[model samples]
Target: MIKHRFSAFLLSALLLSTGVMAAQPDNVIRPVRGTIDSVKGNAVTITTRQGEKLEVALTNNTKVNSVSEAKISDIKPDSFIGTAAVQQADGSLKALEVHVFDPSLRGSGEGFNPFESADGNVNTMTNGTVGKLVNSHGRTMTVKVKDQQKTVIVPDDVPVVLIAPGSRNLLQPGTKVVLHGAKDDKGQWVVRGISAGKDGLTPPM
Candidate 1:
């Protein structure tokens, strides 16, 4: 009996050390602080506030908040950022998610996008980046994180029925907005959500 109890105790300790606790979050979601030093295919060369310029991972849960769009013109040819983020790395951000908002979406009667998957109904995910919505035509409505006017395309397998429409048309031009999505292998974005705020939107740098 003593040996059996010792073995059980040891197993419990091992599980605890391995982080198998039921209380652990499914995945950690938080905001990170940094700037996009450069944008490549699907990745951004971020210069962290700590003065370290490293290539961080852009995940689906990543949310970029700024007064400016993420275009080359929106940022200075040579700019730095004081990135405020919640990440699980000791170095650059390898984003697992992103989130976006349209500052222009006030009182626009925004629409929503819808898609069906064999798995089941889709719901809001903490890991998604762009606004998954649709236009009045029942067409998927996606905008580039770098340029809201730039419509995004989606793969047939990827559902895009989350974002509410009027993101581009309803919101006033130059409306304050935030875009959410993560970089892909080609450095483009997979948006998950969007929003517009009365404040926190600034023009391009």
Candidate 2:
């Protein structure tokens, strides 16, 4: 059941990353990506990419996941993965980043959905099992989501990473992270899940 819970958390995180907001004004959830400035007790100071400094508090229920650098070779025919991609003129999707999920979290977020990047580019997020791989021209693969499938072209320069369960110990200063949460009544950020970089690797998606 732990894997199921983790999958749910990943789906929630992905939704926040895609800029989805709650209909209720009081329950607005968003994603924040930045570098850690400091950590004190349960509070974390983050320096946003825009040069803004924000302090967020982590609760006992906050989930932590580590993202580490990975290679395209790690993706096999049956590997479950998620990729943010832009649709090309030819109707094929070009990957911006590819993240390989842990085996236990195979079906997390499993489907194609519209996505907007931090820079305002509209894309799509595909999370599913790999059906086939073709290396001609570039690395291309067929991703199956339920009965639906998408063809994604992964460029040689696209970032590839792996996600795994992590802990508070990975919350050190200087690390890059993507936080999914909302602000509380006190106007303080309340973190729900933290996707932290490991070994100097940054969370690409």
Best by lDDT: 2
lDDT of 1 by residue, 4-109 (tens): 9999887767644642111222232211223445555445454433445545444545443223233212212112211112222442221112223233332222
CA deviation > 4 Å runs, candidate 2: 1-30
TM-scores, all candidates, are 0.23, 0.79
What would the per-residue lDDT of candidate 2 be over residues 1-205, giving only the tens digit for each residue? 9999999887777764643222222222235778999999999999876677888899999989899999888877999999888889988889999999988777876888776555556577788998899876658999998988888999888889998889999999999998888768876678988999999777887
Name the Cα RMSD for model 1.
17.9
lDDT of 1: 0.31
Q: What's the lDDT for all of these models?
A: 0.31, 0.82
lDDT of 2: 0.82
Root-mean-square deviation per candidate = 17.9, 9.6
